[model samples]
Target: MAEQDWDSQTVIRKRGNVARVARTDSEINSARRAGVSIETQRKVTGNKADPGVHYQRIAKVDYADDVVPPPKLNNSVPQAIQSARQAKQMTQKELAQKINEKPTVIGEYETGKAIPNPKILGKLERALGVKLRGKDIGKPLFAKKDGK
Candidate 1:
């Protein structure tokens, strides 16, 4: 079989075992007005029975006021951990066992050679009955501007 010539104007053409369909300008415009990018529109509308079905655009939200900032870790973590453990009269091995962590991990955290993630830090806080994580204090440095 002879191969068919393909061009932008070709809407439904078969070339050997493969077929192609070109998109109309109105279809492209409809996709754009629906808030779908050109690239994504191809995939979304590829298998749809009616591509004209409108898609509601999701509104973007600012979460700065909704969520609390995570606690900041500092050099004092090592000292804090060590002091709390000593105050409780708990050995490194004992503290590690309580937190289900290795003794060497506890040692490293106390020596300031390693930092614990939030989960591990929470465990340490619970075990030592001390707040290793810093509290969120003070206002943000920048002020929000009102629309002029």
Candidate 2:
């Protein structure tokens, strides 16, 4: 007999398998004794959204007026800076330019209002050839050696 090809034909699935159970006498007795429905209960996996502990945040405030001011240069230091610049026949602006600083900074130092910054002081010392720090404030930075 010749085999027929089933691949070319359209197939239809009419229904799925159903079990019409006939309960045994023992099962029926047990169900009757328990008097409970056959439905299963839902399980809890403890994967819950928790609104966790909240802590109070601390706020930090800075009182600008309450802050201790930066230390100012000594009166002698300012006086030394001024006298050295004047002796060199240089204005505040000219000295500031020579030291690569603002004219206001030079003015402040001359007026005893500026803070003593080591870097600026060094620059001023080199530019003006004066000792602006220590006890000998207005002394020359490099002392004259004996004539060779």
Candidate 3:
């Protein structure tokens, strides 16, 4: 390419119409007062089934009223298990065999060193015929009560 005079070049131009300027605050307020909403329509697309169908607004949730709280683990679980095992005249080893768990695990539970999960707790409950887990009783450990 040959080097030409750079400043001698004429700028290309289109002559059709001038662009519209932004409206003033007073003009916008006047339009609002005349019941003319300047809001732009949001384009809704994606669903090939029906583009006119829009999503429903999410309803507010009342946590305390609408939600049911989970069962809280009672602190007396270890003692209850121990007492129930003794009441049934079953040793930790015997209880462990019945529940298909280790004797050490039973000992840990009895000594309040370990807390068993719901499945193991249920097995122990069935073997001992007691409710070892649930809401707090707020009673003495030795006080006998019906195991429901």
Candidate 4:
């Protein structure tokens, strides 16, 4: 008889006569218990066991059939700034004037292509009555052993 193709689950035996079992993690485990060499190959001289699953599956699925979605995130600080200015019933020119800055400065802060200076941030907060520091000060630490 032709030798069977080897899969992860294909079983091999040490001799011509032995009980056939569907190869499995538990079967390998039992072999471990009964003093079978975990890494050694031995000569077998008889009928092959039927092909079957090896590992005990927690669950199984066809991964090729999944429809995964791309991740979503926010880049909305600029839009938030614009909307807040609008809610305060101010134009770009008016906002700039109230903050004692240029309209282009306000535009840059709103678009997020530039970071606001401390003075500008303070003026914007005071003028617009909104806090722009969404930076979390109270989040839990996942610090390393050195507490870095």
Indicate which candidate wins on TM-score.
2
lDDT of 4 at 50: 24
The per-model lDDT (C-alpha) reads 0.70, 0.78, 0.70, 0.64
Summarize candidate 1's per-residue lDDT along 20-82 as a digit string, tens digits: 232888887876787764553345433377556533321123344467755445777888888
lDDT of 4 by residue, 1-148 (tens): 9888676574575477555553678988988899875663444333235224432231234454575854321255566667778887999899999989999988877877665477876677677766555552112122236655
In model 4, state the lDDT of residue 148: 50
Q: Over the full model, what C-alpha lDDT does candidate 1 score relative to the true structure?
A: 0.70
User: What TM-score would every model get versus the actual structure?
Assistant: 0.43, 0.53, 0.42, 0.39
Ranking by TM-score: 2, 1, 3, 4
Task: Tell how far residue 110 is off in model 2, in angstroms.
Answer: 0.5
**Winner of 3 and 4 under lDDT:** 3
Ranking by lDDT: 2, 3, 1, 4
State the displacement of the C-alpha of residue 15, model 1, in Å, after optimal TM-score superposition: 10
Cα error, residue 136 of model 4, in Å, equals 7.4
CA displacement after TM-score superposition, residue 86 of candidate 2 (Å):
1.0
What total of clashing residue pairs does each candidate reach? 0, 0, 0, 0
